[model samples]
Target: MDIVWFPLHITLFICSVTAAASEAALAKPNCSSHCGVLTEIPYPFGIGAGCYLDHWFQIICDRTASPPKAFLNVIGLEVLEISVEGTLKVTSPITFSNCSNKPLGLQAPNLEGSPFVFSQKNRFSSISCGGIALMTSLYGSTIGGCLSICDNTNTRVLQPNSCSGMKCCQTTIPLHLSAFNTSFGAVLNADSQMACKFAFLVDHDWFTSNSTNISAISEMDSVPIVLEWSLLDYTNFEIYGTNNWTDDKITNCSSHCFCSKGFQGNPYLLDGCQVPSSVLGQLFLLFGGWWSHKVVRKRKHIKRKKKFLKQNGGLLLEQQLSSGAVNVDKIRLFNSKELEKATDGFNADRILGKGGQGTVYKGMLTDGRIVAVKKSKIVDRGEVGQFINEIVILSQISQGNVVKLLGCCLETEVPLLVYEFILNGTLSEYIHHQNEELPLTWEMRLRIAIQVAGALSYLHSAASSPIFHRDIKSSNILLDEKYTAKVADFGTSRSMSIDRTHVTTKVQRTFGYLDPD
Candidate 1:
């Protein structure tokens, strides 16, 4: 009875071993895990039918080569390595030419339907004496290019692993690029066979790690190119569950799905999502602390801006602009950066003049427009309303005799006023400086009187809001390059409503030239 039982047990053991081997051959579900030497094909990528997630991840194992080779389906790009971060390493073909006038160009693979895309890790290179290489995106937009100009004397000392148009030239590609087209233009004076032009996209590591001569690029057929593989299509995980997925999940899925905060894993797979409990606590602490710090900084920035706005009379200006008192477009509110850049970081050399109201700096705008930036020495809390009144009055003045108020910068502790720069010295300098080489002529003096009178007349009567230049003086009158007088400095001016006869205000005027009326 014991011998009979032993024979039955042996048969059962053989059956179990065969079952385990069969199960190992079938990777997940019905997918083949290994294709010859390549055994690391994880989920989403499979060898045969029913094995892979879809046709996009299907791989073909070619056993006909000396050593078995595996290629991505349809595209025939040789597979080198697949990473957990969705990066695929594959062999890219090279295009080469030896003729001097005839330069060869290499085009990237047409990755139309596949889950794979060209990664930014790769750089497009052109090996030649001198030529213009153009890289274009799939949508027919020229992304970037590199030009190489070479000669016999400049041949031997090409920078090792550097592509800066010496012997070899290279440029970076955009991320998540599915397809690109590379073409080469003839190098101006490439006259040697060694100056053979070749172009290809290669992995950065291969270019740096290997001792590759630029002239010997034709000797190489295929270079390692990196690709990024994903789900290719995105399906709403909220609407489609793994157990009840529609055909769209298998076909038209999107590549936008990502692991939520505090969760990590292959977002392309179901149940592939995992939580590393050991590091999770630390990760949460780090991320949460960073988020909270950002929020605090943002709150501080808001509070500071609010304080400055109130101090700079931003509220009063807003109220005036909102009530249709001024044309909003005529008044430009400049930021601190523009003013800082225009004035060469507020260098002392740019100072045009200084006054009690503010200091004026000569600044060149980005558009080549010159302006005089008036920055107040101090922010008087009580005078905030008065500052806004000046801005409002200047925005309404359109007379050619008056200095045009171009814009203002309120982001600083004190508001800055921008005016069209007057090139010549002020009326006071031309009048008082007796030894000055360029004296104001009798006709010029008469023209200056007429221009100042016209500006004053417009301010007093023609303006939408009547203004009185209470502080008019020769010092306040600016002269342009042509010696045309431009009445300026409205800081101490007063405005009155249309129906009002006069504004009741303190008599603020420059001594010796006070308003006699």
Candidate 2:
């Protein structure tokens, strides 16, 4: 009886092994699993026409190449590695400076409207003795960059794995980056006669670990960049609907799909993820469910924040600040939560003043510093540009007579500007509605007038660019604690080059404050 039962048990075990092998297929049935040297062309990313999940995932196998190379069909990027963990490593081209025989201008691959985005794990790097590289978004906004300058000794030696703005420089790329362009400033020293400058986004880990000799980077034409891929809609893939294999439990599916606890393989294929055979493995899955759920929630929250940041021009602001284009040292990019908490959800009681541009609210920051927050009323595309322009202008102005632009918050629907909270009211309040506590004497009035004139002189002549304050008025001027006048509200200000005499524009001024000239 024992011998008979042993044969029956062996038969059952053989059947189970066969079933597992059939279920754990890496690709669709009858489809090519490997292309040339790439042995791991899993499902959703296949070689043949009907094999791939979509056009974006189609891999074109170039058999004519020396070793047979696989390329991502749509983007034409050379495929280096594909991981089921939602990452694809590809060889991306370098943007060479115009000084080189290589094609001029940035040649960054366009990934817009595709399922792939440049992963944050990549860094924007520049290889040159004396060059300033800039990474700009598809919308023409500067996003990331680095300035590499040679030492005074004019030596070609660069420290291994060091990119600290000398000989070689590196900076971080923003989140949700799909497409970008690279540009370089004029050569720092033409007599240096160094090799041509080039910039590219490269996988940070690979670059640091492998590229020990940083000086040799100029000889390379392309670098490995990691791209994160995701299915915009997971419903396009096959769903698991079996015991202990529900869509949400066995296959964690969101914008992207992944095998659940105790499973390992492609979640995009039917029963692609292999199930646990041992009871201990199954028990591990049960305990891991809570942690997995927590991780998913955290990831979703982070993704949402990234989306908001990109939409609110945070990347552009970051680039400007990092590139040293904005000379001010105190300009900060405040987050939405910080500004919201400071203003108590923008309570009406904290209203400082209301204007055609926006409303101002008085608040105290976490650092116990008093600040006046300016929240724009409406935020159309035009308004957003104007808001950014105002930030740029204020950031460049360092005049003592001008209201100091402490920082700005762009994460909100409308951008918010923070300034040093003026203890006293506007000049209009003092002139029209006299303050009983602090009366404006004739001597004080003369001093305020002189300060205002000096601020105007600075704006028109001393400032980096000549600025025209189209809507200057008594209400736009603020008095500090010591009665020092500050020229504020540069929302309608326009900057022009010194060569230009005047700029034509539609009239933008307060009703009674129009220039008589």
Candidate 3:
């Protein structure tokens, strides 16, 4: 009887220890893993002090609201779901319309100082008898549109999960797009009998749930919009030992990491992410370690691309192209993969030159066209507006002496500009490089100078808008294979109205090229 009692007590002790461990693993020390109905407010996002990574990720749990509502700090958007895959779903109020065409438009949500960005998965959509809506970014770039047309005679047939531009229409926004201005097109008095016009950004998934009836969406006060968030500064290689997550450790850190590849859980926990026993065997045995690592790397690469897209104003660029502001036929938007492959993964051997702004790489596109890719060194928030403006200004340039901006890649941390590769290199290289076997002849130098001068003249007066090439130096002038001079490097360039005689701006130029004034 004594031996049996001893075994029973040992079993009870082991079971108690395991239970405690499980509870501790679920959440960080002194931090609640849940808030009211939201039972899974993971690390990096928390409802209480010491639980969240920072003030930007704080969730305000409003208990007064019936059933309790979770709101992201300052933004005040109602949180519907939080995904560890760097995405969240939130609800936005919509204007309701009964019979009269109620002006239905909501100001875009401002997402400054937060890691959150509007996902491409959310579309600018509308439901109305006949209404045209426009979606523009904070900088006044039109991103997308939703136009719904209807007739008073015909009975409307609504299709679920589809916006075919009849009674309902939808258009896509860019990955990092956040704020937007949505306004309905003015209707003629004849169409005053139209029912209502409703337009707002919405999650793609929500369309399938209740998309059968267009009226159902209009009747509802709010619609769901999907947003993406991430730890942009964190790397995939960072890892920690088992079960060591404490409130004090990651309270201020903005990033968290999973235990290993294929593991799915809160990355902030020591043992949070783990392969389940059920599928772990099959995954490891069939795919092996290399395949698992590859998959994990791919996911990390995708997240990085999304981060770059947001930082570089990808949405605005897309909007410009889609809205016909920029001609896509003449200018292309390259993704990270394309540019990487083009430049041999940006190897040192492929480097063309380096400047204070960034590096240029010699690349070959899939079409066998050799190009120069200018990758910026940094992305200043204040400079983003100017960067977009430059793209617009360059796209309009068709002068023969100006280096053609073939396209750009906004899907990077800093925007990259692609130009027609000048094989002979810059004018400075030919004139200053000691290794140059053939020096420029007097005639060639005079011709090059004339070409550059003509290019500047075209930019200043002949163009639709006046452009000021503030930094006009020998280094900024390139030479094609034919040794014809082509004006390049518009990084410091500015544009003004055709009538403006001069514009006031901070002086920015290379050494030995500054205006004395």
RMSD of 3: 34.6
Q: Where does the lowest 10-residue lDDT sum fall in candidate 1?
A: 245-254
Listed per candidate, the RMSD to the true structure in angstroms reads 27.7, 34.9, 34.6
Off by over 4 Å in 1: 1-299, 502-504
Give the per-residue lDDT digits (tens) of candidate 3, residues 150-246.
Answer: 7566676777667787778888886667577776665533455355566778887788666345556756667888888877754333223323444
Superposed model 2: Cα runs more than 4 Å off: 1-24, 98-101, 187-195, 237-245, 248-251, 276-517
Best by lDDT: 2
List pairs with backbone clashes in candidate 2: none
For model 1, state the Cα shift of residue 5 in Å. 77
lDDT of 2 by residue, 228-274 (tens): 99876444423332334445434546667777887766776776777
Model 1 residue pairs with clashes: 31-51, 130-187, 233-253, 233-254, 234-253, 234-254
- If scored against the real structure, what TM-score would every candidate get? 0.43, 0.46, 0.44
Q: Which stretches of candidate 3 lie over 4 Å from their true place?
A: 1-26, 95-105, 193-195, 210-213, 233-259, 278-517
- What overall lDDT goes with each candidate model? 0.74, 0.78, 0.72
